[model samples]
Target: MSADAQTAGSRRSSETGFAARTGGGYSGPMPDITIVYEHPAWFLPLFTGLEARGISFDAVHADGLVFDPADTRPPAPVVFNRIAMSSFLRAPEHPIFFAQALMAQWQAVGARVVNGADVLAIDANKARQLALIAGLGLAIPATRVVHRAADLVAAAATLRFPVVVKANIGGSGAGIVRYDSADELAAAVADGNAPDSIDRVLMVQEYVPVRSGAITRIETLGGKYLYAIDVDGGGGFDLCPADVCLTAPGKAAVSVVQAHPAPELIAAAERIAVAAGMDVGGVEVMIDDRDGTPRFYDVNALSNFVADPVTVIGFDPHDRLIDWLADRIVESKA
Candidate 1:
């Protein structure tokens, strides 16, 4: 066997039928957690958390990921899928469809994958997200889905004034533009100034004025409530939770404050997470100025916890995340 394969086999053998060592002196098998992801910066906290716990994990780069259909059992017993829908912004040439196929393959083989294929599907398509929102009886923005640019103007007419055209498959708030009037949207389309959707699908959604100038993001882990944070929305579209991305030139630095969502909101968020088949994720809700009712807008299966959790949210969420993952690993073994 090759040297690397031999080492892996040795490590796996050591870990079999035994509890892995901990407390910085771990000599057991390497971490069984395999993180499949695209962005590097967003995952630094998770990597740090794993290292701090003396756990070693293998990272699969989504840009060049591959899978063999015939190989039913993957290398890791537990895989944490961290692939972002916004990955197209970083690597436009990457095959996102292939990533989806691979996730489905992983599920077929019964791999213990967090944020599995179902969540990835919902995360990639906004139309599907809207359907899920409506199906769950949650309040969603008045929205219309369109395929061709010619339909953009017509679609805008159906929604209220001051509507936003968003990409059907959007991430980091890409391909979203606000129009004050239908005439403005038509002019943009005529001048070819309208943003092109990444997947050629667009959603014209009514712009509900924020009542508090902020939105609440409730995060869940292992299908249970973990914590919630409020993000100032004056920063515009891109509201990446990672601090590094929050420093864009034109984008205001978003302030994240811990929040306690109402019982109904908490229940609603949990229901959405379950409906989306998400194991770890965040749900965004904004109260409409017109009605004072909370509107569920975004559901994310991949969560990058706000930076400096202790200072921002009063505790480090990654610590709890690590514990959850460890328990999951142990359960998989059983």
Candidate 2:
């Protein structure tokens, strides 16, 4: 998509999914809520819960590229921010800057962001996330977030064959690649990582061997652990449902879930969440079959439980998530 086309799509999507109202417009003493999201599929349950509570809310169409709420004033209450702007699903730089800008716009008019932009910034950066987890004394694999090819080679030498390289951003496993050999890693890096084809630095880590063929994704809201979603990344590079993925497992792939994680893993995840400053987020940890210990991996700010039924752990994660978010939103107000 051309830059103009991309920007236009983002704006249309942001606007279509949300409804916005200004001062003297919304009625009732309830919080005047504005949900900023681009995908309608994600908003349904969230809006449903808000409406169930009889909360007065609006939708504001804003994309990461051209998200400027110049005409609207920030209404009282909070902004449920769920905005993304990267055209390339696999490789999204901190396009969340747009979400930050929107929150800043709301703050100018006297309102609070649900999780706040600062929380998003800190959690979104993979390198930063690792540091936070490490600071919390959690066990993490010997990982490397490198920009240049030479550095990647160095990191590779430190690991066994088959290193995992994931795009620094995006959800549903957009630009996640696994190279079983050093040669494979070199070729993937040369091919230009994602749609942007920008020689962006890729995160290379020692692929934790897993016998179960699934990764454990645990969601936490306002520092409270909710539920765990087992994401079967189909064991390939393209796991993001938004894209065409052949790498993920077909229906034949055996996937299952348990209500609880190993006690140690859960405790570790809780610590990671707190240290990372994630008000509402998800932490992905891979259980190493070799050591039978969980390794902290990805930390997502706008963590998704929405696209559940079809992916990972088969359950209506969105409903549980909506309930959790609504509770937190109300709790914060209280």
Candidate 3:
């Protein structure tokens, strides 16, 4: 069969199956919401949940999306941003910057964008997020930032040995490397070992020892805390809840347990989300084993909520997420 024919058949089957999830009674106008996303598989459950609730949405791939600034109408009344930070790991021609412009245009014409461009700008740049978090009087890891690979060695000198050199635009721990000593970092830099991020910026940061051998990832919805997970870092940098990143080559499988962090941590996570303009996202923090201080590190706008929500978090977060999106859709139309 022709590929197009096969795709059409598969789409029909998918629609039929999605209808079953919500009991097959939705016959409303399509495009109540537009999901701006890149990854193909991560949002399948989200789509199913939206279908279950009869909330019609259009999914647009960020990689090849095109729009004219003069266009006043959005594909839907509400636009949900699912464009990821780790997109660069999948392709060099990733749409990190393209998404920024696209969402800004969507907002300009008054689309009720969930996790809009301003939040995405913070999400895209690690250096900017650290500064933003610090501006709130929160504790961040001791680190140095540099734009040129040549400056990496000098930056590492300020921090103790066993530091990670991270890319400013890294996603899912893409451009992170550890150097145990000054000599090792210098040799890497001399031999051109400095990591190449989408943008040329790099961060040389002191690796904080993880307390209890795990880091905390707290998820938020509508700028409020929804759930938290303790992902065992296990001496690796990538702590994405997705199996794809956790089981990547050279990375061992990590344990994920539902966590009940202190009220202060939950409050802090909510505060960061509100300040960062994150409508639906997650914040990651590592408790410094040496000082017992919780150091906020990563602000992720793209939250593909834990692998199996029911088994992991006792309830499916996607249900609540779709409910919120449905409310936003109603508000947007009004």
Clashes of each: 0, 10, 0
Error of 3 at 53 (Å): 1.1
Per-residue lDDT of 1-334 in model 3, one digit per residue for the tens?
0111111111232322332111111123446887777776678888888877777766555643566677675656888888888887777788788888878988998888888889889998899999988998999999899999899888887787799999999877688999899888889999997787788889999988888999999999988899999998677777888755565677767889999999999999999999998998999998999989999999999988887778988998988998898888888777
Q: Between 2 and 3, whose TM-score is larger? A: 3
Query: Where does model 3 exceed 4 Å of error?
Result: 1-30, 243-251
Clashing residue pairs, backbone N/CA/C < 3 A, model 2: 14-61, 15-61, 18-59, 19-58, 19-59, 20-59, 172-240, 222-279, 234-248, 234-249
| Tens-place lDDT digits, model 1, residues 1-334 | 0122222222221212222211111123545777766665677777767867877676555543445666566546688888888878777785456667777777677668888777888888888888998899999999988888788898877688898888887787789999999999999889988877677888889998987788899999877899998888574887776666676567666767888999899999999988898889999999999999899999988788887788888888888989999888888778
Q: TM per model?
A: 0.88, 0.74, 0.90
Superposed Cα RMSD, model 3: 5.2
Name the weakest run of 10 consecutive residues (lDDT summed) in model 2: 1-10
What's the CA RMSD for each of the models? 6.0, 6.2, 5.2
- Candidate that scores best on TM-score: 3
Give the alpha-carbon lDDT of every model.
0.77, 0.59, 0.80
* Candidate no. 1 TM-score: 0.88
